[model samples]
Target chain A: MQKSTQAGFWKKNQRALAPWFFMAPGIIMFLVYVIYPIFQSIGISFYEWDGLGPKTYVGLQNYRDLLDDDSFYTSLKNNVIWLVLYLLAIPAGLAVALFLNQTVAGIRLYKSLFFFPFVISQVVVGLIFTWFYAPGFGILPHVINFFTGTPTAILADDKYATYGVIAAGLWPQTAYCMILYLTGLNNISPDQVEAARMDNAKGWSMLWHIIIPQLRPATFIALVVTVIGALRSFDLISVMTVGGPFGSTRVLSYFMYEQSLSEYGTAMGYGAAIAVVLFAIMLVFISLFIVRMLSQERNA
Target chain B: MRSLKALAGLALGVSLFATAAVAGEIVLNSDQSDPAPKKAMEELIADFQKANPGITVKWNNFDHEGYKSAIRNFLTADAPDVAAWYAGNRMAPFVKAGLFEDVSDVWKDNGLDDALKSASASMTIDGKKWGVPYTYYQWGIYYNKDVYKKAGVTEPKNWAEFVANCEKFKAAGVDCLTTGDKGGWPAAGIFDYINMRTNGYEFHMDLTAGKVKWTDPKVKATFAEWAKVVPYMSANATAIDWQDAAALMAQGKAANYVMGNFAVDTFKKGGMTNDNLGFMIFPEITAGIPRAEEAPTDTFHIPSGAKNKADARKFLAFVASADAQTKMNATLGQLPVNNKATAADDPFIKTGFTELSSAYALAQFFDRDAPADMAKAGMDGFQEFITHPENIDAILERLDKVAAKVYK
Candidate 1:
């Protein structure tokens, strides 16, 4: 009789709790892996540690040091450059998607080929670009040599190193945006596009006034990921230049890795401070993203 | 039925845990994931197991770069009984933090205080032994004999002669020194030898240990000497790696490379031989400073948190023995740290052995001797100095800023 009563209780409450039950695993994972680490890093930002040694509570000394660190400014500047330049990929991707949207023969093959760079691992892409930018024998230098009558070592020049790495990052990143735009284009309400076409809307105006409004969801996601991606640019810099030519290419992520996790004795507090700054910068974009998401939810 | 199955699984997990706890195994983490070193480690462990007859050895291997990052977490959290690390200032932080066990007793019990005396000073901190060094290799100038002969230049002995020889090599269509500073440390070997030669070994040690300032006039003098040689260094040095520079030497595009003894293999692979390849100590920059060589040693340590301290100490003692070191370094193509071990009759090995044995003191290479952050900052300055020697003041100032922060 007790078992029957318990089963009866479960059946009655199941519908009300079902959604939460389904979301429990994902919520738990996000909380543990993402949310917890952010708080832990923030807490560590106040402590002076060498990763292995006992941590000393320094209370904002790390942030004070960061204010004086020239490398920190350089990384901040580079991150801004990455953000502004990385957004170029979205429009470039949209252009490529529009160009290839035609149903010509072998169009599928062309689309797959266009998506090739995104399919490759970022590390492999970095290696490929490093070789391409190699000073003496690389194709990039040869072309530059032909144009200017002098070869330029792009990655070795501090002024050019970050841009070189950013170009490599942009190659795969642009391909990624292209795929997203392609999917968004496929999902566009054809009848609305046809009606716009009938009304003589085409080209840039058509893209602005008609098609893009329909692709807002895709655009929002692209902006979020691209902003996040630009800030976390570590792997390519590590692979291509290792922030070298006198630390010209270091971002906050790579700088933090160098400080806390590298073979150099760990400056855990300093690295955590850097992480906090990076997180705060990211939080601005995330907030804007959340507000936009909330407004969309209200409209729905 | 379901509850019984769950109970069975729990019972099995408990039994397995009990067995593991009862095993009394000593775990070792190694960075010798390369085939030859891995095999040598296996043989050494086998021999050790045969001798002990009781303690089981569980060895885990990680790749070199990954091992560097993984070591900190393991040392603090899940430390193995024994772990491999580099000697000299590279091991200082771990020792300072009390992460490494004091193994002076192992040195005393095994007579390693005498047997491994050459490496003992580096392994010691605060006058206590912290780790046992197993292998080290010498760094020197590896030159192309063909290029030198074609230029009609003999081995240079002093600053003036070295420059004149550079001119000769340049006239012969070969650059004087082929170094790749892309990784930043190839130029650092040049810096280490130059600083040691100019300011003496004591100043070099003091500089790296952060006792001396980067803006010291002596440090400037070292850069001044390096600046004199800048005209002869490869123009493309900032773009190529060490291997690429070695290829330049092999092809006679460049005359020499200043690197560790390990480059001998690359030289051989690049089709240069003992006949064409010759080794020379970096020429004296100052008349009176005794030549202190760069010979970074590879070592093993007992993590303070180890579960099996006895077995770990036993392994350290065994590693310090001439027999074990000889077998291991023979496979590793490196020099044994034990003074009593006999070296293989290889030309490069013989040269390194003679040079290191006769040295007044051994300073590990720049990256190994200095703390990691300082080394990174210093090497970057060195690379920039090579490109823009006129900006020496700025570079040294930048280095001072980093050294002040890091060495503190």
Candidate 2:
């Protein structure tokens, strides 16, 4: 009787419990690596620690200092610039995908050439851009010198350093988005396009009313990745400028690492506070993305 | 019966751990991953082992970045008997955290107090020696003689002559000075020399120790002096690396570089030979301020948690000796920290030896002398000043704000 009852309970609830069993590894990993560290960083921000010496509790002092910190403001300004400028990748990517979508001789070769930047490591991209803008010897400065009679080392000027790094970041990002859109273009329903063409819809009208709506899923993924990429734009800055020309190119991610983990950095509490602020900024967008996806799921 | 057997095994393990340190064996941990430093380390180990045959060294080598993280974690958990680190304020955190052992007795017994006299102050903290400095390298103006000839200028003898030479170089279309502060610390080298020369070494010591305010008149005076040469510096210096600046000097594109002895190899690699490469002490600013020089030191320390403290002390004393340092630095291509030790017969090394020996004080460079936070902030401020000399007051104010927090 006891065996049968146990068997009956398993039979009844296994359907509900089976998915959780399948998700156990991922869920546990998320809880440990993601959720726990977020709280741990938040807790650490309330202390004065150098990762070597004893930690002293200083209750929001790190945040208070950030308010007065000029570098913090500079990093924040650069981050906003990155977010706004980085969105250009999506539309730019769409244009490229559309341009390359048509069947032609060696179309795959052209598509791969467009995809080359993203295929290479971000470090390589940064190095290429660094050489491209290097002072005196770089091609861009030489060209600028020829045209305007003033040689411009784009990475060196504080006014232009962030934009220069953003341009390097955009190369890979645009390619990534292009691949997404290309795949989306392939999956567009032929019947719907045929119907739209039958009504004499074409060009911008066809793209706006017919193609883009079909590309919504691709657009969503591109938006999410681009936003995250912009937020976590550390490698290019590290390789090209190192938050230099008087800290003009520093974003919050690089700032956090500089404060806490770089060769000269040891301010654990301050770095943690910066991390918390970055997380809060990310949380707003992440929540919006989650909400939109959930509404769409419900509609589907 | 099985549980009892397990208990017996656990007891045996505990007893073995207790006796391990006393078994005539010592473990040495270091991050001398470069070819020269690694070979020098191997030779030093062999020599130490030969001298003390009864004792053995178990060496665990690590790469540079990994060792920095390892030393901190390993010190508190399973530290080696001897570990490689740096000197001056760079080692202060470890000393303060009780991560490093106080080796005052090692200094006294080895007569290192007299032998390594130039580095004595840097190795000491709270009236106790924390480590043994083995090697250091000098910093001065490393100029291209060919560039100077091309510009029809001679090496300057004093501050006025230096400024005059800068004008001559400007006329010749050569950058008077070149430096890249992208990694940030290179600018601090320029700041240190100017500050030390303008006021004195004591002022630099106090300022870096945070006893002096950044906005003080004396600091402004230093900045004022530095402002004269800012125009002559590379306009794009804030974007490049020190190596790039060195290349500028090597290629005859720039007239001078304020750099360390290590850059000699890089210059040589760039096809600059000894005859065309010139070294000179920075010209005097305030005439009577005792001539201080920068020579950053690298050292070895024993962790407080080290198991074989006796062997570690022996290792420290051995490294501190003139013979060991001379031989080791010969391979490492750097200056021996010991006053009695002979530097390599290379012309630059010979000049560096004289420069350091004659100095009234030896600063361990700005980044090493100042706390890491202040060093980084001060260097960033220096970089800004290099680009925008007009922002001196703003930079100083920002530095003062950071100093207020850091010093507190």
Candidate 3:
């Protein structure tokens, strides 16, 4: 009887509470996992910690040290390069999606095959590229030698090391963007495209005016993910170069790892400071994205 | 109603099991994920269990690289009763933080002071023994005897003869030296040995410990000497790993590899026999400087947060025994820390034992000897020096800047 009364009350309030019930789990999760760590890392950035020892409060000293650090600047520059080059995945992905959009025999298999690099783990991708770029043994050097008459080890030269790692990162990222664009293309309103076709609109003109206008939602998501992916590119660098051939391949993420988590010794505070700097940079893009999203919502 | 009762019963069972699981057992974390070392660890645990039948030992094994990062979390959180770590400065930080337990009683009770005499100094901090070392191995130049013979050059005794032999190998169309710095530590090994040879072991220790600046003239001399030999080394070495470079040596394309004795196993696996593979001390660079070798020692420690201290101590004492060490290192293809252990019949082992026994001092390699931040910067500098030898001053200056911040 008591349980039935409770159920009755719940049913009475269900209209008002159902949406909140649905959002509660997601909100709690975001708060705990995502939102909490950002503030926590910021808090830790003010202290010097070795991850094992007692944390000592050091005020803004970590930030001051980071300002003086040359490697921090190098990592920041590489991150900018990564952010710029990583966006290339979007256009390349859209192009591939367009090329494979048509119906044909084994089209499903071809699509799956095209999506293969994304399915493989980044660690494996890094290893494959490492093997590919290894001089005197790897196939890449052979190919380069065949063309240029001199075998070049892409990963060994400091000038090319970060670019080499970036290229490896692009392989999987491009595949991911391709999949997103394929989905967006599948969901496109056929009436508009058909009407454009009847009006003699086709190729680049149709793509730029009609297809792209409808794919703005997918493009926004792709840009957001790509930017985040570029910032968080630690695995490939670690697996391939270990920030070496002289720390030339270090990104901010990899630099943070080397400072705190690596086998050498821990400087958790310094690592957190690097993380905070990276977060600040990411916040700029994120805030711009949010503002644009808000304006779009208002228009809608 | 029936399902609710069953759920309650299941919860009750799980709670009982959880209590049973935590009552009395020693949790050991180790990085003996490799085949031979894994087997050796199993045998050691079995022996320990046989000796202490009352206690339960729960072994948690991780891969070498993963364990390094995982250790920091486990030490302060859910620390194992026993954990594998490296000796010297590597363990010093943990000891200073009071994260590692002082197992001085274990050392005293088992007379490990005499047994593990060689590693005792490394395991000690603040005049207390914080860990027990079980195994260590030698690092030196491993050369192809056939390549040396083909070039008509013998084992070089001093830097001059070594350089001349390198020239001979170069003249004969063979790469003179081979090393891999893709992972960074392999190149750091070269730096460690060269620095030791250039300024003697004391200066090398002081430098790694950050008592001396990287821009010191003594450090510059080591880089200068390394620069002279860079042209003789294998081209594009940074692209290959240590195993791949050893492959070049095994194929007789490269004459020598400045590596640990472990490279012998890889050489053997690559089909180089005892007859062709030769181990030699790095030739003397600074005359009258006592020769010091890099011999990284692997150790086990009791974490301060360990739940089962008694069982952990027993494990350490048993591991420190000469009998346990001999069998462990035999499977590990490494040298036992116990001086009283029976010597292996292997030629390389014999050579390493003799060489290490006569050495004036031992360094735990560059990465192990130096703090991690400095080691990372130092190794990066070393790798940079290899490709751009002219950038020594700039690299050293950067390293000094890092050292100033890190060592402080």
Best by TM-score: 2
Task: Candidate 1: give the clashing pairs.
Answer: A264-B372
Interface RMSD of 2: 1.5
Q: What is the lDDT of candidate 1?
A: 0.88
TM-score of chain B of 3: 0.94
DockQ of each: 0.60, 0.62, 0.66
lDDT of 3 by residue, A136-194 (tens): 77999899999999888999998998999999999999989999999999999999999
Best by lDDT: 2
Predicted structure with the largest DockQ when compared to the true one: 3
> Model 1: DockQ against the native?
0.60
Interface RMSD of each: 1.6, 1.5, 1.3
- Residues B1-408, candidate 2: write the lDDT tens digits: 699789987876685576466567898999999888999999999999999988899999999877876777777667789999999999999999999999999988988899988899999999999999999999999999999999999999888799889999999999999997788878888899999999999999999999999999999999999999999998889888889888988999899888899889999999899999999998899998899999999999999978889888998999998999999999989999888888998999999999999999999999889998888899889989998999999999999999999889
Residues B1-408, candidate 1, lDDT per residue (tens digit)?
A: 699789987876665455342355788998998787898899899988988888889999999889998998788757789999998888888898899999999999989989998888888889999989989999999999998888899988887898888888888888998898888899999999989999999999999999989999999999988988899998757768788888888988889899998889888899999999999988888898888999999889999978789888888888888988888888878898899998777888888999999999999789888988899888889888888889899888888888888867
What TM-score does each model's chain B reach against the true chain B?
A: 0.93, 0.93, 0.94
Q: Any runs in candidate 3 off by more than 4 Å, and if so which? A: A1-18, A187-191, A194-199, B1-25
TM-score, cand. 1: 0.93
- Per-residue C-alpha lDDT of model 3 across residues B100-187, encoded as one tens digit per residue: 9989999999998998888888888888999999998999999999998999999998988888888889999998888877777888
